[model samples]
Target: MSKLAVGLMSGTSLDGIDAALVSIDEDKKMTLIDFETLPIDHEMKAKLKDAMDIGASSNELLCSLNFELGYLFSQAVKLVCEKSHTKLSQLDFIASHGQTIFHIPDGKFKSTMQLGEPAVIAYETGVPVVSNFRSMDMAAGGQGAPLVPYFDYVNYLSDETICLLNIGGISNVTIIPKNASIDDLVAFDTGPGNMIINGLMEAFYDLPYDKDGQIAALGQVNLELLEELLSDEYIHRSPPKSTGREKYGGFFVEDLIKKSKLPKEDLIATLTKFTALAIVCNIKAFGVSKIIANGGGVYNKTLMKYISESFDGQVEIGEYPDAKEAMAFALLGYETLHKRTSNVPSATGARKHVIQGSITYPS
Candidate 1:
């Protein structure tokens, strides 16, 4: 029998909360029942941005936001269930990725933090909650990121070289070559995704994002700036690595604006191209036969055009583009619920496979 569960993901892009109600069987097949992109109030958005900046945020603020986000997450949980006309009793569990505050995936101090207290969610909803999905892999000496590779491998592994790429606030790829084993997986972040472009949009025009490549379509890529941007060392890093808002957020955008001083349209165009090429740089050597892409970035036609023009492999968007990450988290939680180890050791640089997540019971 398939288990019914809800998965929630609030990515680095700060777009909104993605809630997915999905059904998963023991075989790892997922069917989305319903999904919603719940809006985060402007005040909450500003607070989330403040939380991302450790220097500007206080412990009190982080404390408040954690519980506040837990409340918001519970609301989202109810909304998803209600939207699908399914009761809370029908769900086996709630798995939330939570809003990532900061991710330090390197050095002896390697750690990652995500808010939305599981206790609060469980108590509020009267349902069990499983969260903090990255810590176990980190404890096992892994990067604690690019967790989606496990989801991709289970679903897309075959005798074909395929790349499952997700372009969220950051972009990462999972390359499963022909007849690959668990040790053969390759996955890592490809630097900025919608993060930089979204940052530029907000900085220059006070817009949340460039909807559907409209702004980029009107501008031309600045070759000089694009080349300069591509030289960043992260783009040169090997697989089993990951990056987050710290690398591409506020300061990075400010520096780019200062560096190129290009018009807003040109900046968007250049950044979009930068994202496309950075992804191409890493995946070209994999000899990938096809790329199945998801996340907010795939909707940008101009970005897609840039990537399609530069690559030789076939490119396709995922069927459940919007809900893919949410459903993936749901599946990850399902594994933990089963006491199964789901993190891909090769992809995450973990010493070994380990089950991840902290389970909390309702009050």
Candidate 2:
């Protein structure tokens, strides 16, 4: 049997919404039919960034933005369908990795929240919507993150030990051992990915990003600051761990600025180096023979060059490199509809395999 589905993702980068239309066959093969990224407008982006702040976050605001984001995701689906020349009636379901507002993996009350109400999406799209994909994993005593490793396992399993590195706002790596089984997989956040660098670019240069690493290439890295950054406690933490803006958001970038007297380009260069070094260090520890990289960070040529020079193994781009995360959610939604356990316990440190996501029917 073959089913057409749409996958929606709004990552930590807060850049845009990525929507992917895909076809899944009985054998569980995914063929991406069409994909598009809709840039988030400045006002909405500011509101979302504000909501991430504890002091600024309010019940009424968070409540409204949830539905607002739902509508935005709905629009993304409709646009992708229109672009693909598909109809809503022809779709199976929608898998939405809604905007993550907060993620506290370690605390007395451990929980994660992603808002973009599935009911709203369902109502708008007239299709079943699967949102809140991480809560179930957290309920099972897992980190409720790096959920794409299950998709990685399904698509990238091979005879060689390979690391799948995704560099969005935060970077995470999925380590699959040679001739891997579910139990042999390991994945965790490598540290700040494009988060710090993007923040710096926006603040200092008034640019959305350091396109093609042009800014960083012009300056020299402050190796001392890089060493200090690498010594952060999170960098040394063992697996089954994850982190987000709480640790690397605006405040972190501000502190970096206050600590350094370097020029803007030098600071960016240092931060870029820090990001690549952190990922390289983590991957090197696993001793993987091959590394497959994806996410928004892969587009940074300087960062990619730094990573390539640091690692001796072959570094390659992933399949469907641009839409990898979006496609993963689509696969996860497919698994959920089939009542299959989609979470990898080894990667998430869950007690056992469990079906993830909550489904909302249009009618």
Report, for every candidate in turn, its global Cα lDDT versus the true structure: 0.91, 0.91
Candidate 1 lDDT, 1-363, residue by residue in tens: 899999999999987889999999978899899999889888999999999987888999999999999999999999988899999998899999999999999998789999998899999888899999999999999999889888888888898899988999999999999889877999999988899999888887888888998999999899988888888999988887899999999989888888776788988998999999999888998999899999999999999889899889899999888999999899999999999998988988999999999898887
Q: After superposition, how far is residue 362 of candidate 2 from its true place, in Å?
A: 0.5
Q: Give the CA lDDT, 0 to 100, for residue 212 in model 2.
A: 92
- By summed lDDT, which 10 consecutive residues of candidate 2 come out lowest? 106-115
After superposing candidate 1, which stretches have Cα over 4 Å from the reference?
Answer: none
User: Model 2 off-target regions past 4 Å?
Assistant: none
- For residues 1-363, write the lDDT of model 2, one tens digit per residue: 898999999988999999999999998899999999988999999999889999788999899999999999999999999998999989989999999999999877679989888898899889999878998988998989889999999999998889999999999999999888988899999899999999999999888789999999998999898889999989888888899998999889889888889999999999999999899898787779898999989989999999998899999887777799999999999999999988888888889899999999997
What lDDT score goes with residue 184 in model 1? 91
- How many clashing residue pairs, candidate 2? 0
Error of 2 at 54 (Å): 1.0
